[model samples]
Target: MTTLLAASQTAALLPYPALAREIAALLADALVRVPARLVQALPGGASLFVMPAFDARLAIAKLITFTPANAGSGRPAIQGDVLVFDVASGARRLQLDGPTVTARRTAAVSLLAAQRLAPGNAGPLLVVGAGAQGRAHLEAFAQGLGIREVRIASRSAASASALAAHARTLGLQASVADDPERQLADCPLAVTCTPAAGVVLRGRLRDDAFVAAVGAFTPAMVELAPQLCRDVAARGTIVVDTPDAQHEAGDLLQAGLDVARLPDLRAVVLGPARPSPGPVLFKSCGWAGWDLAAARCAVDQLEQS
Candidate 1:
């Protein structure tokens, strides 16, 4: 019988640590096949995304909608579902919540990259957005990396405070930052999760700092200042989560950086030597392979249960 998992149920199955492990394994093996996803334009400045991926054991497709206008409308900008199928029998095995998978997998990818590229995994993360992605990154880093403190920064004070409170509930020392740029210098690890048309974070960062820039997936959106990208590239290393980032990573593209020359997360994962010296910047653009890994994780957990 086919099973459908709700958002909460899906979350329970794909824990950060396990999901990170699966992502690492996927990267190392490089067996999963993910073709370019199709994006269809909708009437009201919205888009529909059809992403598909497959491996020997399982095949999955994620259908989701992206509506930028939903911001502040008490509705999510992205929503959808992931359909998982058995490869050998061509039978539907499970259905996973799309947004939940996107959130967890994206954060898991960051955690994996941080483990491989970050100067250090120790505490005090600075998160630039207080929405779902911010919350997911907070929990992923705190639980996966043993981070004990966090600083929240967002355009909305209420949202920032709420995320801080949520962090406190997780037994972490949390506070809202009035100026995220000022906090950047002190934060050793950070993740930017905002959806901004312009730069939302920029400043001098500590030499050992590591940042996962997950916001602004399209070329037209940007979160980090152009100078920041140039600075990181000059001082340290800038790694992309996937090669698709070359086309979709607005932060790097807007910075006038040649993303094609940057090393991808897979290289960092498979390399025997650590990333080059200095701070590291990891740019993530959503990929179907990530969702495939999430599906594998969920199915494995379900079988064990």
Candidate 2:
């Protein structure tokens, strides 16, 4: 029988530290394969995404729907499941909750990027967007990077307050920022998790600031202002999660930056260390390889438990 894991159960299996390790390992391993995902448009600004990936031990496919309009409707904006299979036997192994996997793995990717690219890991993190992605980034950075303070910002005051309160419960100093852009200079570490309906983050960052821009994953959606992206490209380093980001990273594209010239996470991970003088921008456009890493991590955790 194929074991099915609920959202909570799946999350419990993929802890940030372990998940980050798995993602880092996969980034360094060339054997993992991910094909282009299939995306279909649905009515009322919704989309269905079919992503598949495989490695020596496991194969997985994630089917999920994204509805940007569901932001505050008490309904999840993303929903679906990930089907995991054993590579050798070609038998079904496990079914994982898709949104949970997406959230955790995405944050883990950011965490791994920060570990390698961020000038400093210890932080007073400025997280813009107090939704699920924001919460996941908060937990991942707090646990994985030892961040002791956080500032929450969102279009919704109530949502920002809720995420701030959640942060306080984690034993961190938490505050809601009325202007996240102004907070950028003081907070050396930040993550933008907004929906990218329009630009939500802009303004100057500290010279050594590290930002994981994860909100905008399409050509039309963008969170970072064009000027901010250009500044990073000119003065600092801009790294993408995958080569697919060349087409999907609206933030960089809008800035008129040649994304093809930028280094990807894998190249950074398997690097011959280079020096960077200014802020680091890590742009993440979701990739199936991340979900495959998540599946491997989950299966490993299940066996140990």
> What is residue 207's positional error in candidate 2, in angstroms?
0.6
Q: Rate the local accuracy (lDDT) of all candidates.
A: 0.92, 0.93
Error of 1 at 161 (Å): 0.8
TM-score of each predicted structure versus truth = 0.98, 0.98
What TM-score does candidate 1 get on C-alpha atoms? 0.98
lDDT of 1: 0.92
- Tens digit per residue, CA lDDT, model 2, 92-174: 99999999999999999999999999998788899999999999999999999999999999999999999999999999999
Instruction: Name the runs in model 2 displaced over 4 angstroms.
Output: none
By summed lDDT, the worst window of 10 consecutive residues in model 2 runs over: 268-277
Structure candidate 2, residue pairs in collision: none
The per-residue C-alpha lDDT of model 2 at residue 143 equals 93
For model 1, what is the alpha-carbon lDDT of residue 234? 97
C-alpha-based local distance difference test score of model 2: 0.93
- Per-residue CA lDDT of model 1 for 1-305, tens digit only, reads 78998999999999999999999888866568999999999999999999999998999999999998999999998899999999999999999999899999999999999988889889589999999999999999998999999999999999999999999999999999999999877789999999765788879678899999998888999999999999999999999999999999999998999999999988888888887789899999989999999999999998899
